[model samples]
Target: MAYGIETRCIHGEDGITREHAYGSMGTPIYQTATFAHPGVGQSTGFDYTRESNPTRSELERIVSSLEKAYDTVACASGMAALSILLELFENGSHFVCSEDLYGGSVRIFSTIGANRGLTFSYVNTADAELVEKAIKKETKALYIETPSNPTMQVTDLRAMKALAEKYGLLLIVDNTFLSPYFQNPIDLGADLVVHSGTKYLGGHNDALAGFLCSASKDLADKIRYIYKTTGGCLSPFESFLLIRGIKTLSVRMERQQENALKIANWLKEQEEIKGVYYVGLPEHPGYEINKSQARGFGGMISFHTDTAETAKRILERVKVISYAESLGGVESLITYPMLQTHGDVPAEIRERLGITDNFLRMSVGIENGDDLIEDLAQALKGE
Candidate 1:
């Protein structure tokens, strides 16, 4: 039967039911450490837990199907998946990436490149020309994030795809914020897509997980090799939990997006707020490009107030929204990018990108939009 994402999510990869069997509708977690082999020179799907697991495989298959990719690899964390992908490049090979990305990603790249003599140049990928200009002869990959971190700056995936094709570079997109339901970069020509499943896909702020999806079998195999050898695979239990979380993604995202729109609109009207950045609003710099690609604007929003003092006060006083770093959960979270998500970013770069001390980011939740608005109104009053 043809089904929507919400339906597939609940039933996806959970497996067929045995007739007359009394069982839970949810996918059971297979917590065993290893599986037995059929015989010598024969494999029974899973031989070692480190290499593979039935639970993880089911989650991987479901995610791959959701992303419309040939295959996917689930990892212990998002950074692990990123590490496996970066291993595809030889030492000294260069990568071009978005200047404003998740803080952890930036730190990982900097540390790895410093040790291995690998190179990366960060640029404003929102500007197509700048991205094209940043490509070098040794450039092997183009890494990007849309509705990027604190800035909510949108990148043109189709434009990036064209540049990658012209330069024979692999395009990798971080589709964490929008997830597959809101934006699937593979559909727009990305060779691969990555996610910090700990955020949205897991939904409840529970299990930590990550995934990488690829359309090319050869590319998939390369990633799989690194994944298996590095032993960064997710545990079967976590995989099953993540699968359960993903079943509610569509519903959660819908409510979150709606709440975000309301919050963004309210923030824009505040006198203390300098600017609001969200793709849903037409006045945003990235709105046009974002509209061209995504089905709807996502749940993340960031705004700059007049000063750090006001921002701090607002964060300190916010009632409904928790002061937290992560985004894309059922609970609303507010973070000061300068101190939290993008703290590791160079001050000079952060200033240039407008991720100043005055900036505050919000990941709206499924709660009543009116309640969220009231909470923010009170917080702004205290500020």
Candidate 2:
């Protein structure tokens, strides 16, 4: 029987029926550098922790199930996944990427990737024509982040897939914002889906993990080969933590998005707030496109305050919502993109994207909507 995403969250696609020595409620962490050989000219399935581990394999299986991908690789972090992914393309290959992406992605592509001979064109992917215009003979892929980081710009994935098909280019999507419970890019024709499993998949400010899920055997094999060679596979213990965290994925995402929608609505009515960027809001430019593709708008919201001082002061004043970096945990977090996530980007580009000093991005937790609203209310009033 096909399982719903909620069921897939707790029990995975196979339920708890996988054969294990001890029938433990949770998947056990292998926590060993190497696995013992069964006998001469024989092996135990796994030979080395870096190549594969039972715990990490289980983590990959569950994430693959969530993404509806042929397979997935558990990585040390999101950047590691991107780094390994870059290996699939030859040197001097160009990629058409979304402009409003995670600052770290911009940093990696421009610095390390450029240093290694990979070139990138950053465009507003919300406009399919703009993305197409950026493409050329050297372009190998279209890399985009839907409901992009901080600014929440939503790109039409199907349109991008069509562009990829026309150009014979790979379509790579970062599905970190709306976790697999809410969106599966593979189903929409993306060749690969990327996740910073540390955020929603791990669902706590605890473990750090990332994943690359491939839709086809060829892509999966390529990712696996690079993954094993680079040795950036997630540790056994972190894999176990991520598996534990994913078991609660459905509940966490629902509650967080619910809180996010409420918060977005409240932010719009506040005189101290100038703009609110959330895909859930009907007034948002990409609202309909997002609703057509994703099951939910997710927990991230970006709003601009009346002044930069108000933005900074609210970060200091909020009691219920903490001011910090990283997101998709149980605790609500408000971040200053100018200083935090998007700090490395050029000032002119930051201004063009409207990610200014007065802008604030929020990761709504599963906190009570009333409590979160009251906290925002007081923080805005300087009470």
Candidate 3:
């Protein structure tokens, strides 16, 4: 029988079995740096950990299956995955990118990639016309983050695909916000899908990991070559943690989204709140498009308060929700994108994008919805 995504999450591309490793039920961590060869002419496939490790390979295979990709590369961090993917483009290549993305991504493109002869144009990718206008003859790729970081702006993937095809540009999507359980960019014609497995994929915020998935074998192979050479591969222990974390993705996401929707709705009713940026909200501009493309609206929500003072008070007062920088964990996290996630973004650009001092991003967890709301309520009310 063809398995559902939830089942696939548990079983992975290849189902778990004892036969694969001397009757071991779980995937074992091949912690060694090098696998011993059977003999001079024979091998055990894994010659070196950098080239490949059994534990990491299993995690990659699982992500590949989840994303419906021909192959996947596990990296040490999300930036590492993106760095490997960027290697596909040569020097002097330009890219059209989403204006509102993880601050780290903007930093890489503006600083690191710029030093390497790469250039990028940032636009509101949700507006296809703007993206089209930004494209130049040197543009080789479209890098976008749907339900973009603090704003929750959703881009039309099919529209982007059409543009990419017309321009013969690679379409790279940052699927970290939704995770594979909620959205598969590959199914929507993304040339590549990048993820910060450190967030939702790890689900616990304990392990840092990243992944790159691609349907094209050629693209995958190129990325794999860069990944190996760069030596940013995830360690065997981290791979094991990620594999374990992915098994509960379906359940965790379901509960997290459930709580998020409740919190988002509650936030909308609050007198102090100015706006709630969550795709699940009917009033959100991206509601319909996000509904059509994703299985869930995701647990990320960003809202604005009446003033920066009020926002800071809430951030400091929240007792149940931790004030942290990362998201997609089981524990609720509230981030100030202005000073945290989007700090690297230029001040003018951030103001234009509405990532202001009053803005706050929340990664709702599996906590009881009522309790989470109560926490926010007390925080907002300064109780």
Q: Please list the C-alpha lDDT of all candidates, in the order they appear.
A: 0.88, 0.92, 0.92
TM-score of each: 0.96, 0.98, 0.98
Cα lDDT tens digits, model 3, 1-383, are 67788987888755854336687768798888988899998988888999899999989988998999999999999999878877788899999999998999999888889988999999999999999999999999999899899899999999999999999999999999999899999999998999999999999999999999988989988887898899999999999999999999999999999999999999999999999999998899999999899988989999999999999999999988999999999999999999998899999999999999999999999988999999999999997
| Candidate 2, pairs of clashing residues | none
**The CA-based lDDT of model 3 is what?**
0.92
Q: Which ten residues in a row have the lowest lDDT in candidate 3?
A: 12-21
Looking at model 2, report the run of 10 residues with the lowest lDDT sum: 16-25
Q: Which segments of candidate 2 are over 4 A away from where they belong?
A: none
Q: Could you tell which candidate, 1 or 3, scores higher by lDDT?
A: 3
**Model 1: per-residue lDDT, tens digit, 1-383?**
65676666666633432211367676667798877778899898888888888778878888987888999999999998888887888888888999989999999899975567789899999999999899988898899999898798899999999999999999999999899888889999999999999999998887889998998999999988888899999998899889889889889989999989988999888999999988999898888888888888889999999989889988999888899988888989999989888888999999999989898899888889999999888888893
121 Cα displacement, candidate 3 (Å): 0.3
